[model samples]
Target chain A: METNMLPFMRRLQGATCTWLVQIAIRENAENLPCYAPMNIIPVKMPITTPPPDTLRCIPEFVLENVVVLITIARRTVKLNMDDADVVNLLAPALTLVLTFMGDSSRTYNPHLRARLAECLEAMLPNNEDDSSSHNNISSFYREQIFKTHPHRFQLVPCLLDVFVGIEMTGQSVQFEQKFNYRRPMYVVMDFLWGFEEHREAFTSLAREAEANMEAVHPPIFLRFVNLLMNDAIFLLDEALGNMAQIRNLQNAQESAAWTNLSAQEREQNLTNLSHTGMLARFDNILGRDTIRTLVRLTAHAPFVFCHPTLVERIASMLNYFLLHLVGPNKKNFKVKDMKEYEFDPASTVLDICRMYVELGKNERFCAAVSDDGRSYSPKLFTLAESVLVRIRGGDLISSLRDVAARVSTIAEQRQRDEEILANAPEEFLDPIMSTLMLDPVILPSSRTTVDRTTIARHLLSDQSDPFNRSPLSMDQVKSNTELKEKIDAWIAEQRGKIAHTSTSSTS
Target chain B: MAAMSPSERRLQKELMSLMKEPPPGVTVDGDQASQNLTLWTVHMEGVPGTLYEGEKFVLQFKFTNKYPFDSPEVTFIGNNIPVHPHVYSNGHICLSILTDDWSPALSVQSVCLSIVSMLKTTAGQFVLC
Candidate 1:
């Protein structure tokens, strides 16, 4: 059953559309659904006896064709071809790349494949009207490649493996370029920059891959994510008094939001508070989105989006943070030693604490805490909670305590307001309601009665001041003493009046 | 004595604040009041019942022009360097923050607290000296 492979190869060399039609039709049978956004690939094409010795040299053939395509693409000005034409032209070659990715048993030289990348980067549509090519390629991936490898999920991880040399920890894996593979993803990302359509494919794929990984090994995946989260947590912890620290990175908010914090005004940021603060504050900036994506993927214990895996992930993260709280680690966690990770453990504990409290009643986390078989400590939740109450540990106790106290006060105040509304004249009721009545001791801002913890959490995620619509800064918030005194007096007065009324009613 | 740089000023401020509200079991050496802002002497009493309990250790904090920018040179001296694996007999401490993990955000107060915490956590009997 020998068919002529040379003539089709020649046509591909000449950049004729007829060769594309032939490959799309004939190759589409075996590599069915491996074409454009049309056919969906079900499972990785089975290695049905290597594509003959002639087809084994396809990468070299593709390289030669790319060199010619480069010259032709550069020469043809009025070559009004859309993304479909380009995808069809390169569909057969891309099949070889996908096939290579699928079968790890085959010999792969990442640097050699870099020539293929150069071709795709070259073919990235330069004009605005034809900008849909990146999306088209992404769709082609989402439809077909998705079916072939459901667990492999996103192109990002594979892209990272190719470009960053990260997921290269497997047996029988040899490397020609054992150094840096960060360029491939960045080059592709750079090409797809500014287009949300292209980015979405990555985002969803990343979500799927993370979900699958977490579902398989919740503890390992979280440990990896927690370690990676170290940088963003450190940045957040340092951003205590000055929101300017992190806001400047995301380039978020107006310049007025940046309070020109002088050296004298060295306000303590989240790190100054607790390592836990820094970790939780990760909800802010690019790190926040990434963490949210990761969290979104993992199933938190017991519910929709609350899969026990997420609980396990957080629990495992808490365990490592606890070990590293006071001192340097003896060895590396993965390839690098623990000594390489610079973080404050007690503070990291607090960050994990905040994360747990925010998650609230994660049954799996609670269950893991009592189970000794879990990594780190089975007494995880209990030990961490004890740390929160410890003053010397940092602001975890005080900050969380402040939030609890403030919440109770708000509850008390709301009850009194209802009584006032029920009994008082309509005119006075308007005035009473008109006045903002909250203890500024726990809530520093006058624009609204929001508790400090709420504001702190919000600031951790974003820089905007919710009450004033200004760039919210941690340092600018000061305790309003006068307001606190008045709110206290008002609550006292309302309580006394209620007492007197109850006595009179009984008499 | 060189005119105070910004680091010196900040260190001086930190020293005053630390003296006002030193962490539990830590006391600033009275003699440091008369010295230049560049050097500080602090006394830390070990916590009760732990390995370091009942021990009295003196710590010397020496700062450079890069004081806050660089971590201060901190070590135990004058009788009691800690008898722990991480602490050397020569009075030098093996903690990373005093060297590699130092941040400008960290003050003398926080550093003292951390040192005290490290001492309280000493469980191993591998005393070097």
Candidate 2:
């Protein structure tokens, strides 16, 4: 008879847990005693809200009871994780309380949001001992929370909002109060850092969901891609905006216009310069976090970068940034050399370029980047060459530099197309692709001339002769040396035409 | 627009020449192709006395940035896919120039001419059901 009661007992246990959780969340609930030492809690309430009459206050008793419930749920899940019955019983109650806390962050009770963040931090797995088991608990909760939400991955975005809220407050008189949420954000980041398995699982699920239906915004995975990409771009823009101001001020001081300004105006300009310097410091710290997240995303969740819109945005941003860095009249931010700026402009530039390199390693990503007419390959190759020049070591760099050099050579050959097309004879053109061929080669079987690069790309997917259907290989094709010489001479003659036109126009 | 890619430069030149002097019975939708060099829609008609005479057709060409070197994916599109043994109802064209026999020597004009000739030769071998 006792063995038969086991299933009933499990249901009874779940009902009781649900009742307790509801009681804890009630408006005027009574305080519960701390289960473990207060120190074990990951975050502390550093400041208190004003008197209850002034603002809507969450009853202190309810806050305490909720924290106790959170601690209990976290510990139970961590210890008896292997027991399916135990985990199932606790997950609902915990998810209910966690969802309430998450929703509270956006509510009118502002101070309670901070208090709830402490509870959230406490519930996260952060014990120094048995770190792996703690991580498993967090992972289990991620899946559980996602299962509850209509859109998944709400956890990271929620924590990110809280984190952004804290960062927005900036430095204030109550420094500890303002910074208390950082621990929760850091723990969430750690969870995501070890989130490879979950990432792949959720990513595929999101992709399938997307294929089945259309939504206003992209799937959560792509939203994260947009979020991170936009964050990096926005931060870089802020830094650049400050530098541009600095440039203006420096220019003003150098020019004769400086003497014409009022003393107050000059002083105001100086003050603005100093203020921007301070903001640049803040940007550096913020940028470090953004870069870390980006690096992790590119490392673990690269498929996210495969989205066409996101890839285009990244390519354009990279193009803008690289051009800014290397273009004539480059602005050098003093922050680049300072030890304080962990992610200075120079490092940010390098990281962005390296991110491109990292993502470009995958063939699918390369195909997307190279598919559109607004292709960024030449700019990227130029950047790769510059990066190679700067890093100047490593086997990978040597190999990449070789590829970059080859592309650069092709780019050089194509750069004169407008000039050559104006006067080059028809016979000088390749039998294929019509453009003046750079390295003309004669196909053995077809007895026709084409650019070597053109044929090489063609042979990647097919081996037969384009004209005769003969089995043709790269070795069978020979350089059309006579045609190449004539084409090179035509190219030189076009350059002379350009020079003459420029001189005549200037005169 | 920063500097055009090599393919875009080639496409620019092609677009210019086509607009200047399109082949008989073939006209490019220049405005659409100019907006995006990667995808083009061309308006083609069967030559005057061929089997497809007086019939209008639309051909869609999708070029990768690797154009010229990589042949564009071409197919008959819109409501008027030419009824040919090689043309599928779904706008997929089974032509050798599109796949195996593609060479970089080909241009947009050359492709249009080839498709026109293919339509000219079709005489009731297969029809779209």
Candidate 3:
């Protein structure tokens, strides 16, 4: 446990191959199998617990040991790619590091753990050389790792903690940091993609965690959702920032200074602008990847993605990005400003809309996105169509077209609602927001009626009647059943008018 | 229209009403606000008979996506922020309605009226000080 023992162990570890021998003995006890590239042998090691004292090291020391072991495993695998026995020798050591990931009491650095995970995947016996043996080794290691903790999954959630920090602080780790801050996220998606069991386990955990956001220990999945949305927001903001830069440079080129500049200086300026465009293009790639992960995650669990606040947040992001993609009047989606500087966010857009389209395919998710039972954000539907039309043909096109058809149906219903509102008496509207009330509830203290959603949202932050400033809670509000009946009848009347008008026009 | 949030719909209605029948001494710059619903600027001229009479002021309103449920950030924005007991040099106002006393029933028009009246009464009382 002594801090100085770490450096001594590091030196001793370097001096001898004793660490590998110890790991081999440990693996022998567990009967864990190791696979050579084209050959297979199930190595049997009896399972035994390490000494109690060995498990009692300080957390920081454990972290250093983990880092050292991960480096060795990575280098061992890379240098011995053709030597399956050498690569296979590091399996037990790698699993031990993974088990270290299960120790909840200690916080392992996410970047290091991510590297360890990537190294584990790389160390998997070559898939083509020995398929059955690869499955056995991978499955056994996964079971051992999952058995290390009560929850059965640790590494991914722990890795996601870094992203949770980014969401809360609103500052992402810069791309320049060693191993880069985003390495864990990329590794997480890659890890999940490598193993189907991991994806299934992750989807279930995400659903469980989502249902309990206010739990004492908030699940990393909800924060992960926030992180994905935040990434989209920040990436789009970066794109907008780059667009502004391009505009400024274009303006500068048009200004009187352009003619005054020497030819050499002009070339330098043009090069700098193109470089900026390249950065924008790089951001688009990152954006597209993030959206792909988001879409995949959403497909796994629509309920988690359709959580009310998240649904709203995602809709807002789509709205902003789509508006930018398709300029005003829905034309000018693809903009080519400078040669070799083409920045099209269409792929990212398609990914996001693809997510929306997928979510819309589910009835419950559609209702969640639009609580009023009409349609999801009409503006989003409008904006998406503007872009979807420009796309020639693809699976995304057919799916998005389906969403458009649904939106039109909802639009007709909405038009009927608007007609009802136009004829609605002032008393039918929510006094606070001035919208036609749905599920009106009367405040006891203020003697005012507002829509249920409006009041519920208001009470979340401040438990007071907005009209009277008197302390109030949702439980005290009474439903305005009489007004509800009147509004229903009124809407029916408007629907009749719409039905007549539509029939007449068709005939 | 279907996708517009409750806050957006409310703001749209308020914008139209304010444009069609603006209150005395107040006019909203509609064209500027047409770009985004969450932010707006209103032009206010000092009410007659007040110490700030003939003085012009600009108020900026910033609404969150959750607007009616949450109070907008209201501040005196332009060069002629009023000199008053409740007005900070940085254009922040200390009026109660801008904070805890705010009601969802209040609109941009009501907030503008409150600021104008605050300028009149507060500046009147402190004019001789």
Candidate 4:
């Protein structure tokens, strides 16, 4: 029962629960008749003003929850709660909320709704919110409560009814009324998802209520996504199941042959599929109309797909899928027709390039892809150029052109460096011009062969030359191209001498 | 312990530890009613003898599934703002621990202590200087 933790909990509950505990202990001091734990209830008292103890304990920030939990817990220390007891307490509790909900639409039903929230709040596994709660229901106690108790608590679905309001019954909730009722519903969802048993039902109810909530409410599914994304039980696949993109994706993914294919095979098939022909591979999974709808949504309201920071994620995922139809490091993903795809890779790159532009609404995202100035293949450059031409984002277009131009220029420089290397002398064999410290200033600067690596090491502590002991920086060194030509000629002469030696030895 | 992901397990341990022996002037609202450990709302009280004493602030922590591996997004929320050099008016803290100085060994408890000490140091300087 963790009786040692009791004092800490009592301290946490502070004055309010302490006052209740003091009264209950004082009244039952000599030991009253002990009842079976499960059947016990709070001592009935008039629903009147303040008890002297409660009057003294009330804090400025009201936490009415502690008083209610202690009221219930005072009767029985370890509450052996069952489904019936939960339903009995909470159903009546909800009714009180609904009745109060009628009288006060302005302030809302704070008095009773807070009590209901408190009741649910008390049953949670111990934490800070429950710190103020005196009930201190053990984790084991809560587990048993759910294990023994079936779905008897009707309060959750009832709250949904109040939340959605006649939507289930085909009656519309008034626009203003819908806005006001969200808080209690939010509270109910928060409490319900805490229980392992209730999460599925909550998600299912969310699915059913989604259609009705479109106009008045932000998609309630997002709340669950926000909470459930980290949970192993709720995969990203399941979270996005209702979205057309995921639905179409799932249809394509669940294909028998597609599922059975090895990852290499799947990567091949998807990469090979023609842009319009790509619809054929997915057609086995989803209808043409569904794929069309999925594409349309992406083209239209792309923001609907954005879950907090998922814009980048979806963009990267599309790039990956376009590149290799399978997920990163994922295997056992198999595909058929391994040998047959010979169309332009640009088509596939361009497929995702559109969304890349769409996602480039974030200036930072645009700069990362567009301004890198790395040369792409002629195919990708054509695609990028055409994409830049289409997107019309001013910053992006100039950057894309700049990156393409820079990459080509870099490519030309690299080719020149290679040509210079083919003819270089033995003295210039080292790439960093490490063998000779030829000065860029063109004076009698370390004409003797000096390894630049040694100078670089010295420059780490002392940014000066080792030999002359003068001020020197790595930037000050230049390659001795004359020595490079001499080395190349020497290497050619050495090769000729080796050829002459081999022929003479054979004779 | 092995069953939970590193982030989940670490968060669980931190949650229990935080509840058991929380940092002074710091309390996390134990409303894990979402059962999602990735997000937390922490309540902090300005140390009693400080310039910002008697003030209450709430900090929202958003942790990804790759947390510890990835740093949590911690930002202050509420009407009250502590006028400190390291704290932005927009509630983005300029603390190194949140960015370049982050290490996986640092938990919610340590972060809370770091923030408390930062505030204390600032308060001490404000008074003495």
Candidate 5:
């Protein structure tokens, strides 16, 4: 069965060779139209003379195939294949003859010479092997196969692959050792063939090295890796034409996706708002927890927050919720301050207590109390007293009530005083009332009534006694007039001082 | 120290042309007596409207043996540290152009301008290395 298979293999090899040769002839003839009939003829030409360009056959292909077969045979022999088997194998036999022709130094037909060089190269050992046989075959291939078919398209890639494999295996040392005993022509051929065939592979290996660089740990290795990657990139760039088709396709797809999604999203948002009642649903959807989570996430992923669109969305949402919660009049509350627990109602109570403490330090409370006294309203007094008590207890509600009481008291007192003045005689009330009002110790209510006469008299008499002592009713009139004048003068002086201070400070 | 070679003299003349006329808040200076004109000392006034405003900084530039063919080694000098995430406490700047993005087309003057621009345009409290 093995013997039967051998003949069949030989036939298959012959058929493959015939097909490859035909393809090469056709391709070459296409470039040199005059040699079409010669390409159809399979007759072997003499190796001594250069083939005429008119023949139009790629001699390099035939030579390369022969060298490749010879190398394969040698590899098989190393594994203990019989010499008779190699001679009988059509592919191997053809390869050996081509390799010999390529190895010969004699000048021949230019095309045949180049083809011979390629065959010799195919038989040459890679940098990984550098064996004597490999060196000899490689030099022969360069001179014969490569020189003849320098422009052979397939030969370049095939040679490159062999070279790349050797480099990747780290067998340069073995290659050098083997090549040392070989002819200079063979050594040079091995290098050239290795570079041409393995250019891409070498580059890829280099790129892999660069990708795995450890600058400190392996400086030399890193440099080597970078060099490999750079060479690979350079070769690839030349091998592959500009990839405009792929880029254009990618761009089109991206644009389509973007536009389609954007339009769909806009429509979806509008529909959602209409169906769900925009404001109410939006508030329900994004609860306090959700907003808090968003803020936390934004803080963690600052890059997201850096996006203007994202920032605007968050800001708008925050403003919307705040406006709803605090009404327009209280908008200033949001800007005024931020406390850790202010977001919690319980903590807001503490802030209120602090505010009341601040308000208590102002003397405005005195005016409220005096106004309350004049009205003598139990309800107003009770409210004020309750607020004061609450404030003392450090309750925020107390501060709120205190503010309300003071504002109401001042307004009510002013109204009542206006009503009284409207009914009373100007001369009778104005002079006495104005004089009493000027006294700091006298309340507005006390100033209107004479029932607190003793207190009023002491207050009026203690200060320089502007009204002179006199006997009866007439003296009382004069004393009252003089006292009113003196009181008015004192009030005017106080007013002037206050006005000057305010102006100076404001400027 | 070795005397400046002819090539080094040519490079220095080329570098001088590339240096910009100092803008409102930028300055440049170089060592004159050094044998290698590739090494330069640069001073810059911080651009206003930045966190580093009103501060002065110094930088050192050491071109490789293959100037124009390779990038320069730039480092900050003095104590005025750049408080940026990309800028190390030791004053080593981690800009792309100084490393992977470096091209032969880039000049010392353009690099300085780019650094100033980077400081100006960044709005965050922290920078990205």
Candidate 6:
């Protein structure tokens, strides 16, 4: 078999020669031959190979030799062996291959040919230069390259690898000059669109890539991180939006559910739900970082458009984090050490109660005992009542009354001080008086001595002005008094009816 | 379904009122008459000084059958999403009070406010899992 390497070389030499001749006809065709012999042999041999695998393999060895020779030849001919050599050689080949593949009359598998072309494209200069050509390259990928061979878009990884190589070899300045115009966002957006188009596959790839982050080269790793971070934030926002919608639906449904329950049943149900055990599970899910991302994503969302459940989710996570922070076994711990604490409900409650005492937040103390009217545990109520009574002289009611009295005294003192100040010379009164008077004694006493019965009576009482010296106006006070009296009367009537019924049953 | 008890009715009305006149910078939507009114859909516009600025996000809320007394379940709704470190891609949130240390006194409004503030203060930072 007589092999006609001449015809092969002619064809390989054909395009470059034609392009050079066209330029030469205008300037100098003599320079064309100098560039021709170097590129012709390598490119021609690969094209003439009988097998596709042989053709594909040829570039590995042939490219380097051809590139070096082409570089030397270009310097000899044009006085510069710049990126123009690679661009001129690769671009024309790419254009030719792409155009050929796009032509429907060609019967060969365009997909395979496109894939092969991509492999070759990956070998081209990965410049760091921020140039118009770089932007054009990126846009080309986004518009033509990606569109033609969507599956082969993974070639981005290879392209990125080449860029990393260029960066590592100290050619970054030159590369940047060529490619710097391409924004990171463009590559990121391209990856995102590709990922979205193939979600499951991309997700797996992402996971795999993340798992292998340590093995990746520094520049490629950084690019991957940048891409991942951007995508993660974008997806988080989207996920959060969907979650908000679901939450709103859930809240509306829950309200309807609550309405369907009887008053007693509703109270019982709410009480049961408020139990520490149930809340713990709820917290576990919401307090996870995932919920934070969602909440943070839609925190300022408009109420009508925002998820109603966002608040609930945030509340759940906040409460959970706080519980972990201040709950029993959590004391003497820094925020960093919170996860070390064992989650014990009983201990957590005790810790909370102790904290309330330490902080002198009476409101919180009262809240712990009466979280929900129906679910107030007899044991917890007794314990709280005992603690209150022990501190407040064996009277829960009196303790509240004392707090009320103190509050009133403070208010009156504030009023008196203000009145005196208004009338007095500015220099006469001490400037320190306002601070002293306004400073609330957060810790009123070591403990309260209020019993359960007394606390209940105070709660139920109509005439008992527990928080003495009300803040309301006379008319408002009168109206509140009337309302309280009606409530008290109704309660008394109900009690009397229950007593009568019990007595009749006993008889 | 049986008629609602007065207390339940009051809760329903309160929920309705919240939906109709949600606090400023908050928006909510979902099925109105569904059996699980506890769940809802929400969209939030990004506030200034946050990483989420100029972005819209979604959330899902699933209230326990015991709601108000018990906090609802909230989760993010997307896959492989970008988020601040504070946010988990798994839809978990890291806010305080939703867990064991909850106070019944904290309302839905306050929770949302806290989240908004978190976004404002943290800006580019995120919660770590």
Candidate 1 local Cα displacement, residue A145, angstroms: 6.9
TM-score of model number 6, chain B: 0.75
Error of 6 at A420 (Å): 49
C-alpha TM-scores of all predictions: 0.31, 0.42, 0.66, 0.24, 0.30, 0.23
Can you tell me the CAPRI class of model 1?
incorrect
Model 4's chain B TM-score?
0.86
| Model 3: per-residue Cα lDDT over A1-507, one tens digit each | 565654454454333233322332232123325321122223322223442222333344434454455445434533422333333334344434444432332233444444444444444333343323334444355434433433334445544554554333223334433223454456445545556666776677787877774344446787777777777677667766776676667677989999999999999889978887887766655665567778788777777766654666665565566656654633322334633444555665676677768777765444444434223445656666666667642557667767656656655656656655675788888877787887888999988888876776676567788887888876788999999999888877777887798899999
Q: Judged by TM-score, which candidate is best?
A: 3
Report per-prediction Cα RMSD to one decimal.
Answer: 21.7, 18.9, 9.6, 28.8, 40.7, 29.4
- Per-residue CA lDDT of model 6 for B88-117, tens digit only, reads 778676776566434323455556666666
Q: Which candidate should be chosen as best, given lDDT against the real structure?
A: 3
When summed lDDT is taken over every stretch of 10 residues in candidate 3 chain A, the lowest stretch is: A36-45
Q: Tens digits of per-residue lDDT for model 6 on A1-507? A: 235542343245436433432222232234354432233222321122232222222222322333333334323433322333233344444433332222222213323233333334342322343232333443343334334442343444433333333232343245323223123323333343344343333344444444443231223434433332333333333333333333343353377676886888867654543352233333332223222222222222212111121222222222333333333323322222123222222333333233222222233222222222222222332344344444442433344344334433444443444333343332222121211111111111212222222222222222222233122111121122333344345445555665687799999
Question: What is the DockQ for all candidates, taken in turn?
Answer: 0.02, 0.16, 0.35, 0.01, 0.01, 0.02
lDDT, residue A178, model 5: 20
Provide the DockQ value for model 5. 0.01
Return the lDDT, model 5, position B102. 61
lDDT of 5: 0.41
- Tens-digit lDDT track for model 5 on A66-173? 445545555554443343443333333333333233322321333333334444433433345545233444334433443344233333232222222223324433
| Superior by DockQ: candidate 3 or candidate 6 | 3
The per-model lDDT (C-alpha) reads 0.46, 0.59, 0.62, 0.45, 0.41, 0.37
Tens digit of per-residue lDDT, candidate 4, span A310-426: 333343344333323212221222223322322222333344455544544544343233222221232344455554454443455554455445545554544444343444444
Q: Tell me how far the alpha carbon of residue A400 in candidate 6 is from the true structure, in angstroms, after superposition.
A: 45
Error of 1 at A196 (Å): 20
Per-residue lDDT, model 3, residue B55, is 89
Residues B10-126 of candidate 4 have per-residue lDDT tens digits of: 576577778778888888877661377888888999999977799998887889865664568888888876778778888887777787555443677777887877777753354
Ranking by TM-score: 3, 2, 1, 5, 4, 6
